[model samples]
Target: MGIAELRAESKTASESTAALLRELVAHLGENRTQLREEWIRRITEGRLLTAMSKDEIFAEATSVYDSYVEALETRTLEALQAYAQNLSERIIPRGVETHEVVGIVLLLRDVLARSLFSKYHADSRLLNAVLDAYEPAANAIAITVAVGFVRERERIIRQQQEAIRELSTPVLQVRERLLILPIIGLIDPLRARQLTEQLLRGVRANRAKLVVIDITGVAAMDATVANHLVLTVEAARLLGARVIVTGLSPEIAQTLVNIGVDLGKMNTVGDLQGGIEEAERLLGYKVVPIAEPMPA
Candidate 1:
């Protein structure tokens, strides 16, 4: 065929695909009730969404079914993406996992594909054309939903991790230009790095001049984490903050020693109270003893 004839053929094919999709959407809408119920039944049989009660599952299924159909019909995913994010927020807190969310979408896709096959089986040519138009849209919709849920889940997970990091490594302002960080529990490289970050942020936020890090609650520390502690001290010094480390375990002290870390750099104290007192002293806070009279 000539170029003009080829162009006309392509336009006709595009319109024909759009018409097939419109018919597919209408058929799905007409059979929404039976198809959705069948999908729900399959979900129940598969033991998915067990975190939700039957009514909860049914309600969410209805919303998801409508969104799924809308996505396929419109060939757009913004509405479906928003719905998936909202659904993830609701269901994730109820212990719904990524696999469960993906599972139900695939199940719905399967159910709808089977229904389409049964509807168009008598006409082989039309069946092939319908399937050709439907499968790509169906796959795209499923990917959009699954991706939305995963992104939301990842965001929530990061939020929770930040909260945990704050709780685990607490940097408190003891006095003007003085802050204390009481680190408890095991210090892996990740936690140690988080500790460094929290301390640095606190120092900058408080404009802290002297910092006391108490690791009494810490059971042990490896050489790598000890290096992180040393690096933190160096970082603080560069930021115009002096670091005092307290509650050093024997193993950790030895690890620091073996690593040839300069004790002058770390400025170790025996305990949290001593570290605070030293911090206060360094900040020019003097303690005046007050004596009580025997008789007034």
Candidate 2:
């Protein structure tokens, strides 16, 4: 396809993909509600049926529940398969537009039995039956045509995150004056340790008086994570660099308090802007309204 045609096609595919996802979400939600209600009803009925008979009532109730679960599983499998087939046909009418076809196929592959089972594990037999049908449905949903789409998405996300992390971890701006470091993803011990090393090296190498450690992208930090942060601050102090912690989420602050992490010695700020202001103050500089002329 020509560039304009390709762009148009891409836009169309993107819109369709979003629409399909919404439809799939709605379908799954409806099915999930149905499954939960059925399971609840069956379990409630089974509990009431118990006559305190140690053997007969228990066995009968178990069997009845199992039968009901199996029937439900069969219905779910048929419905999902029908849905997948319908979506596939709609996206790829005559000759498959390779990109759009792949996207639709991947939608089926990414939704797996393990996830569904996690949601509906009240009945093992039903879960197994769903898996049995899900496998065939996924295979038949023309996944072969777009098998790499999911992988491509995963790869793109990974690359973008890595780039953001790199951006967050700042390099030296000026000698013994400024430094930046970014913490990306979850703040775990391993990542924290790595970040600590990066900060220490960057600070020492650049002779940074102020080091900014940004954690805006971090999901959460456990006690171990908190310890790593403390260690990094201590290490930076030893290197004669003031550590400026940025991106202090209220939830993270609460987590630190709950974990008994007293960030007393290290300076904490709301964001990079606050950190910059604090850094300027610490350096005995002020943001004046007018730029002062240099005395020759």
Candidate 3:
């Protein structure tokens, strides 16, 4: 065919596809009750959405069914995408897994497909055309819901992780003129920055003469993190608090050396107990042992 002929043919096929989808959408709407009930039955049998009560499942299933039909009628996914994300937010905290979310959607697709087949089955050509129109939309709808759900889950996880990082980085006042900051786990650049801020605030607030930073739980550090550690020590010094670093792992010590960190300027100790003793010595406190009494 000539280019103009081919272009005209393509437009005609596109129009036909849209028309078929419209007809299929109307049939689904007319049979919405039976089809949605069938979908819910299958979901129950599959043990999907088990975290939810039957009433909760029915309410959510109704919303999802309506949204799915609406997306078909509109031929766009923006509304459906928003609804899926909202649904995910509501249900994820109820312990819904990704497989469960995806499973229910596929069940819905199957329920609707069987309905379409039953309605359009008398004429083979007509049935084929309707199926052709329905398959692409169904696949796209599934993908939209799946992607939205995953993105929302990732967002929640990141938010929780941020909260945990803030909670874990607290600088604690141990006694008069003494503070201890025990850092553990992995430290990103952002967390390293937080360490400096927390240390500075604690030293000033406590008017601490000595601060012990025990990094026994930390396994290693990169050059950037080593620099951040050095900066945190200097910030405490500028605030008139002498900093003692204990639990210097071999790997972290090498990272500091590689970063050109001058260990001579930083007071180092072997363990938390040794660092506390050294801090007490600098504050002119006598180390006297008092044994605990036995229980009567």
Which candidate has the highest lDDT of all?
1
Q: Against the true structure, what is each candidate's TM-score?
A: 0.85, 0.39, 0.72
Runs of candidate 1 with Cα error greater than 4 angstroms are 1-13, 284-296
- Kindly list the per-residue Cα lDDT of model 2 for residues 24-108, writing each as its tens digit: 3444545654544443344344343232343533343343233323323332233333343443343333333445444323432
**lDDT of candidates 1 onward, in order:** 0.86, 0.55, 0.85
Candidate 2 C-alpha error for residue 213, in Å: 1.3
List the pairs of residues colliding in candidate 1.
none
Q: How do these models rank on lDDT, best leading?
A: 1, 3, 2
lDDT, residue 284, model 3: 60
Tens-place lDDT digits, model 1, residues 42-90? 9999999999999999999999999988876776677888898899898
| Tens-place lDDT digits, model 3, residues 160-242 | 98788878877888778899999999988999987888788888888887899999999998888989899888888887888
Candidate 2, number of clashes: 6
Q: After superposition, how far is residue 156 of candidate 1 from its true place, in Å?
A: 2.2
Clash pairs, model 3 backbone: none
Candidate 3: how many backbone clashes? 0
Q: Give, for candidate 3, the lowest lDDT window spanning 10 residues.
A: 287-296
Candidate number that wins on TM-score, 1 or 3: 1
